[model samples]
Target chain A: MEVVDEGSDGRVARVSLLRTPLFEAHRAAGARLVEFAGWEMPVQYEGIMAEHAMVRERAGLFDVSHMGQVEVRGPRALERLQWVTANDVSLLADGRAQYSLLLAPDGGIVDDIIIYRQQADRFLVCVNASNREADVAHMREHCAGADLVDRSDEFALLALQGPRATEVLGELTDTELSEVSSFAFVDATVAGVSCLAARTGYTGEDGWELYCSAASGPALWAAILDAGRDQGVGPAGLGARDTLRLEAALPLYGHELSLEVQPFEARLGWVVKLDKGDSIASAALRQARERGPERKLVGIEVPKGGIARQDHALLDGDRRIGTVTSGTRSPSLGKAIGLGYVEPQLSRVGSEIAVEIRGRKVPARVVALPFYRRPD
Target chain B: MEFPDDLKYSKEHEWVLVEENVATIGISAFAEHQLGDVVFVELPATGDEVAKDEAMGVVESVKAVSDVYSPVSGEVVEVNDDLPENTELVNDDPYGDGWMVKIEMTDPTDLDDLMDCEEYQKFCAETSG
Candidate 1:
């Protein structure tokens, strides 16, 4: 939230990064902090691979308080939401959330958001931290007299994710977390702290995203850690989060979904509901759906050699088809995996492709969207 | 960071244990800490020839990728085959079990150009500080 220092001319003056409420906790835990999206967040605590394995086999805690939240409250909230977001917000019942996209008129993504229908007339939208200011400004213009409030600074968000997450969190909350299905949420007191717990996560795991008052972050974090210490619940940072999400094939805002990348091209067409009525980018998305997207996002696996980073060219012989959006050495899969946009014909699973890394074309192949899925 | 007194060190943070003509090479404990949880390692073939200060292998960590340079030129006689399967060894026991390659040095005199434990420690502190 505090990564930018603007000069009088509106230019970026200096990198005066902001620290989250859990900054002290992270420091005390001996975390490696890195500047990400204008926030000095811990990229790793113990280590990425160890933390990643712990989350998959046990449980892990994440400080995601840097992410932005905006509340749209008014009688016309649904109308305003429908007019701006690409997803059909009407389908979301109260206490439910849906992953949606804020799009420009040309079908380009402004930011990927999670819209929580708190009530018939009140919605809470969670957005990427990097796009907080822009997202708030954009929504303000289209709020149509609705109460648009930036609530990012007021809450400290925590994600207790992994297989044992429910067990760890259940010890502190009276709410039956198991009853809350995926994408559902409830208001409850956790660890003597009143918080909003949502059954949603970026990691492909069963977890809860808890939002509490900024002042209560330290106690809540300590209570959860102490409760789950024997269960192997350790603190994780953004580094493990990135690898986990990449393994699940989730799209990050700057990496996968960008201003130049449309949802159709990102293989997120399912979220775009043309029948939801005349919403932002609906016409263009409708045309894209009818005709077909020029490029489609697909999973690319580098069987061997170097890891493909963002912006690396996806090549078919000498011609460039597309570029890598997000990539990492999957700690779960034991191989290199990446998400990238390529020609629709080349998007098929098992299609052969190559990623140009440092001038050499590394052999790769197309796989399914999600490289990893939790065993039910 | 632990830099063994008996080993020769490179400014790049590699440590070499020279026994006659064959030299065992590995990254220092300081280097392993900085890299953070190595997931994958790419080692040169056993018979591949490497020059001093040349990039000989790659270490892919969860955070980023880094090149492993040869401290002394020679033919790679042996590589830790267990590394590709258990890259965590590089972090667990960087100086001992995590030794990357054993090279038959083309010229053992190259070892004199390297730093001792005290010098490498000072180098790490200066750079890290």
Candidate 2:
């Protein structure tokens, strides 16, 4: 880790960033490193477009070690989780995962998370890197009787995703990965390393997210790459990750889910169980459901010449509509795609809208999300 | 990495080739390398008037969009018609076919603020380090 100091004026400040266990491996592979969530992580290994295409066509490996993991276990773990989470945690059977959110008192999202049920009294919670500490503190404040342990640093997570991911991962493991249904995981061994392999991914592709010891990250990464060498498996970075997830219409913590934005407006109302009795923020959320959301999150498609970057305003012929949350040139679609909030009436599938891109009002339209769904 | 001795460079990494009063403009090799995989390019119109140190056009990659700044104030005479469709020219041949626009200079004295090849190379080094 490098601690760089900035003294542009008289005052001095020190900035030190943490690194994943595969930091040296990424450096040796000639990746462009960037600061993400106080961690030094790779933004790109090859070009973003090429890597994006690779993940869609073949398999790609991702080092998602920056994501935090917490083990919550006790006699009251299930009851405690149901109290803090927006989703009904009681519905998940053992080895099943549910996408849920931690909400503030005002029904604003604290962090979107994945709760993996390991047993009746135990669960593993996966959280975004930036919100890990805050989420832990929030959980502790609410669930004092439950045992909460931060295990983010103790494990490294690797996501292998694509159309060919099953075939590639099959070569190294004896388990029948095809039988493991979506959002379910099993304790398995891959490439001679023990891992909890889950059939879940952010890329909206058929894949497995392997959670193993931090010390085994480098070897596991190399072995998977080597095992899939003939299938053109490559290491993907944050740049490709963002584009892939956006095409899937998955909400990021800062961009789509935030402390200011409530769940219903972000198209996350399905995850909020207002009828689930006595949960945090459920009262405020029930009132919000009674009074429908003013703005709804929709997909935006721009024409030629302009790329709709974040914070660009959405307009309906000079009428202030909403603001863009995240935007990028879709490598798979070969067109401009973005996510933004707009008035509910304007959120229809083919409503015509325009986005302000660099002082010009480019022609845009509200479109359906999950812009690039994989072939069935 | 290749900065032609006959050309002048700006801190924004644009290169200018002054042929008499008209200055031809393009991004340098370093800029193209830093912005990998050029996906779109928007050049100024042929008759548009451009001001020095101001945005003249736009270049977009997969992740970001960057504005191309003019090094000399001028009236655009010729624009790159091939670049909008063949954006890879900016990354492949940044000095030749990748040339963005040719402008008839309004103030030729703006060339005094430009850096030569050696100076531009040193500037890139210091900024990168």
Candidate 3:
């Protein structure tokens, strides 16, 4: 690699570690560090492909402490959350988490979040690290009687994902994960660390997300890692995290789902509840849903030769049709896979398109969502 | 850390093993380590002509894509066809089966301007720090 000297300013202030308690442990395990969302996080430890393969075949642990967690409590919590998020919170049962979107008045997505109803008067919302402050402010502004509190500093989040994740996590916690269905959470303890363990993950695998205090995070991580040593619980990084989520066809905050892109255009209509009473952006969502999105998100697969990349022009012969939003050479599929916005007519599966790769148009076909799916 | 004393190095991290008019090119071990598990390689055509320091090809890892710079002006001769099917060879055996291309050098004198193994190693050490 060409090492360019983008010289530092030399102002040696105390560089904050946007760290979980496992920060030092990760460094000790030989993780290559990179800056991500204002935190110095590991991009990969062993290698991307190795870690990715491990997760697919066995299990993997991911430090997702960089994600923001906020608690909304009081009698009006559910009502206030319904006003801010696109999904109806009244439908969510206690200990259940629902994926929803916070929208601007124009029906564009502010941030896609997961709202976990902890109790009748309390709910926890997990948001993107970069958009945490904005999400908090947005919720606070819209909330009338509910108390909005940012608990990101008090808690650390860890995702144990893969097929063997249940076996690994089951060894540590007393609670039976089999009793908890997908998207459901339970308050439990692992190695004496008070944790809220949920059966949810971003990797499209069977996994559990553990939220605990900052001081006890490292101990919990170590205990799980130790328990899962024989099960091949590799520590995954942001590199595999991106590829795995992309292969699963999950919409990322800044990519497929963005402030300028409506939920309908992003193919997240399943999460938007239109008939659940009037709320902010509900009218706009209804209008968008009725008319149908002008542009729709579609999965693209390049059969041969070139890999389609982000910003690559999508073409129908000579006519430029759309642009690729997220693209990568899928390690699992062994082909170039991408997600892009195309005209609704061209978004059908099996529809042929072309992607201009290095000035030459390469053949691509619109494929089904999720290039890879884990076996349930 | 291993640099062959007989090879010439470029600032872009490509190492050239020159034999008469033909030069074999591959990224150095240091380069492969930094790039981390090369997932894709865009090799040039066999007949394509490239200029000194021009974009020879592209190498993609899981994280980012980097442009591979041509170390010297030459006519494209033989590209490593195995790379597309097995890009991880660049990470495993970067200087052997992982060699990207073999180019017929138009000007052999250009080799003199490139860094030697000792100088290149020192350059890498200084730059990484």
Report the number of the highest-DockQ candidate.
2
TM-score for predicted model 1 compared with the true structure: 0.92
Ranking by lDDT: 2, 1, 3
Give the 10-residue window scoring lowest on summed lDDT in candidate 1 chain A.
A1-10
Tens digit of per-residue lDDT, candidate 2, span A117-222: 9999999999999999999999999888999999999999999999999899999999999899999999989999999999999987889899999999899999
Best by TM-score: 2
| Comparison by lDDT, 1 against 3, better one | 1
Greater DockQ among 1 and 2 belongs to: 2
- What value does the interface RMSD of model 2 take? 1.0
* Model 3 agreement with the true structure over A41-83: per-residue lDDT tens digits: 8889998888888888998999999899999999999988888
Q: What are the TM-scores, per candidate, against the unseen true structure?
A: 0.92, 0.96, 0.95
Worst 10 residues of 3 chain B by lDDT: B60-69
**RMSD of candidate 1 to true structure, Å:** 3.1
Q: lDDT (0-100) at residue A220 of candidate 1?
A: 98
- Model 1 ranges off by over 4 Å: A1-14, B20-23, B46-52, B73-78, B102-113
lDDT (C-alpha) at residue B48 in model 2: 98
